[model samples]
Target chain A: MAQRIDVKDLDIYYGDFLAVEGVTMTIEPRSVTAFIGPSGCGKSTFLRTLNRMHEVIPGTRVEGSVEMEGVDLYGPGVDPVAVRRQIGMVFQRPNPFPTMSIEENVLAGVKLVNKRISKSDAADLVESSLRGSNLWEEVKDRLDKPGAGLSGGQQQRLCIARAIAIKPQVLLMDEPCSALDPISTLAIEDLIAELKQDYTIVIVTHNMQQAARVSDRTAFFNIAGTGKPGKLIEMDDTSTMFSSPTEKATEDYISGRFG
Target chain B: MSTTAPPTGKARSRSASGRAGDRGMNRIFRLVSTWSGALILATLAAVAIFLVLEAWPAISLGGEELGEQISWFPEDTSIITFVGPLIFGTLLAAFLALILATPLAVGVALFISHYAPRRLAQALGYLVDLLAAIPSVVYGLWGILAFAPIVYPVWNGIAETLGWFPLFEGPAADPPRVMATVAVVLAVMILPIITAVCREVFLQTPKLHEEAALALGATRWELVKTAVLPFARSGIISGAMLGLGRALGETMAVLMILSPGFLYSFAIFQAGQQQTIAANIAAQQPEAPPLGVSALIATGLALFVITMAVNMAARAVVARRKDFSGAN
Candidate 1:
């Protein structure tokens, strides 16, 4: 079984400005958890902190504990590089290495870091990873083509495949469907559903319908006022959150009454 | 329902005049742009034609036999001895400078773009720009007085330590005027241009591409290798070509650093043995014999051709790898 991610009293800051404050959440293993909020509510910020991806930004800091399977990821001796290998991320934009071929991009995580895989094993890994992301049938024939030459949706799936090639226990996606067309969104949604069976998945999305449709659990986050920190308002099973949200802000946000 | 339409007799004529005025202004802007573009092309063509005309006399008087004759003057008032060595020197020095400058330029660019703090990078970039602006003659004087002496001891140390190698086995002499010294001066002269171009290319590496690599567990160095370097490779090559072009045409620095001989030798440290095309023309053009003048022009034409070929090759490489930006 995959390990769960535990976030305790997580606060995110960009320079001097606090972005997200007092966010506490436990992401279950083998479940699809969706983060839905208005723009600038720090849903992506919170998600980035889960895997220490936020630290990549200059002057961005996190104050809290993020643990994976009982190991504190932000401990002094821990390496962020190793943390990222255990928990992968897909950006809002699908950015496969433009210079690498499709097959190369798929196996880059393994080959660039490890450099010990045999040619036959690499080929199998590429095929299996693409197949796991539901992109093998579409791109198998053109494995040697540049990853940049793929369509937007296909490229996103290729990125997902690249992420999964390393076999990360958790996947963090920041608005993965926002850049895609409707058809591509459906393909990614389907892939996400399948992915949750094997790994823990946390996605931040502006699309409430997507959150309701695909997520096993949903966390609604919102900012209170100008210059205020974004906070998690409610989190529960997807159906319950939509049907009878425990908080009025969650109900108001889901029904389009107010943000 | 009954309705009444208002007349716009005065407003219609006024608006029509305004439209005509606007069109006239647009026409003037377009004409200016077109004329400027044509003038640039015409200037390039005029320069090319002038160089060819100046070189015609040497081209008509062949140098194939004169090369072997070893005489200073042609048997029939032709002069070719000076040119062969000059051309050889120019190309050799340029090649040497490129070899020395490329890696250093790349390092400087990478440091400025990826490693240095924002203000420090900008300050260093300004310093490089200042180096580029320093006059060529100033560099020549500096090479003769300061650089040559400072660098000679190092060259001597290398020759002593690695004298068994064919290149390092040259005799030590005063002032250290040699092809290798000339090449070093040329490298310093062109370093700024290469670093600036490479910095620009490195800066243009897509942020998302870098972030993608970083998000996927790549360290800073790994991100540079996977995302930044590959994207900037072609751009760096193009920048190096630009530097090479500058190095090939640089006259004063090479003239000061090299002993200026008409004989060609592979030993870079050998004084009184190397000459470059630009230095040759500068050395002899004032009181040159008629054929000697033409031959120097011919060498210039040859240098021009080489520079053009390098530029074209750089363009081709850049075109094939359009995604790579060579900005530092």
Candidate 2:
């Protein structure tokens, strides 16, 4: 089941360098929330901290809290691995395990956890997940082929299938369509709209139009200057944020006047 | 150097030109590199020809010729039969060493490349490389003096506990200058070679793939299994093959550590029970008559063929898996 995420004064750091300053937001369950910002603005950094994926980099630290279903994800006893199991992530580039077949790539989340699934069960999950990502039709006939052989769009879709196969409560996508062509980007946007019905979705995008089209809520992040930590500027309903933002900076950013 | 070149205007006007000097240097480089590559094949062919020509007498020797005592060719057998025990010993010793070293080498490699802290990893990598730099003669000395005594009790324990197994069936060597000790020494000798290559490959695993595995809720070991190991599989095979090549042809360590013998027994802990082809050739060459030298060369040729076959097999394995590794 999808769960609401409540962030309370969260700060992110890479060693001694603070990357994202104190900020707060509540992400609703079963809704599309978009994070929009220019490069190095810490929108992606903040997104990574949600599932604790940023901790993969050495010396990265998180302060304050990210809570889901009233449980603090950054609580002392929480395992990052377990946190990740509940919150799946997709990266800017599609990475379907190069050594695996299309079907096996879709099953990577479960298989990597060492779960035992019957042949029929594995087939069903692969089929359903691929269909969910809208990749089943193009790939079903060649499920045994290597995943790396696919086009960029198909590979990204395959990665989406992999993430959803684990059935996480929330999904974080870091520029999922940034590397795709416009047609492929539209397909992913449609998939996002459908995915939000069952899973809480958080996306980071450079394309403002993408956020406007797919997201129910939009959060804009901005950096004050070089070497300054990025801060959350504003967040509001998609229509309201696009049309009449309370902050001058948010309006400037949306209107292409400044970042 | 600049003064020797053509005028700048002429040099620049030539459509395909970089610098006149560079074009000339490139031509020389191509010529030298081509010759260097050709030299390798020429030397290999020369070695093969020399072996066959010198080994001709031993190849043609019959039982009657052996009785004539033209030269000692294993007393009663021809060169083909004489090489049987040597071939067996070479394969067994190298096989045992590979078994002993590959997992340990891969473990140490994984630790250096992934598990160790940054500074410690660099230090450990250098330490392993330093081991490879130690000469085979020094390893031979260490094998007989330090390493052999250290493993003597363990060898005896194996003979006592697992003596029912053919490989362990032994009244262990008195001074322990045996095939089993020699195999251990060879394993240590080859460990750094495999570790160096494996560490390089493991370090080269794509960051994207590793992050994918990590984001999938994979543990450290699981990530290694799913991402790092698969990508490094071909590299590991090639590394192991290189180590095996060294073990197979290693003469100094085997000669100094193993007491030369002419038996086909699998009992490796017994002294004077086995001898590798290279070691046998080295050991018998000095004492043998002229024909005996020919017989040794024949065995050397055998070693060469075996090493070549092993390398070819490794290449085939690597090539077969190339499609799925995304290395293409």
- Which candidate number would show the highest TM-score if scored against the true structure? 2
Scoring the B chain of model 1 against the true B chain gives a TM-score of 0.83
* Candidate 2 residue pairs that clash: none
Candidates' lDDT values, in order? 0.85, 0.91
Q: Write the per-residue lDDT of candidate 1 for residues B167-250, one digit (tens) a residue.
A: 677665557898778888888888999999999999998888887787778888888888898888887898899899999999
Interface RMSD of each: 9.1, 6.3
Off by over 4 Å in 1: B1-29, B62-82, B160-166, B322-328
| DockQ for all candidate structures vs. native | 0.34, 0.44
Off by over 4 Å in 2: B1-29, B66-72
Report the lDDT of model 2 for residue B272: 86
Instruction: Give the best candidate by DockQ.
Output: 2
Assess the local accuracy of residue B171 in candidate 1 as a C-alpha lDDT between 0 and 100: 68
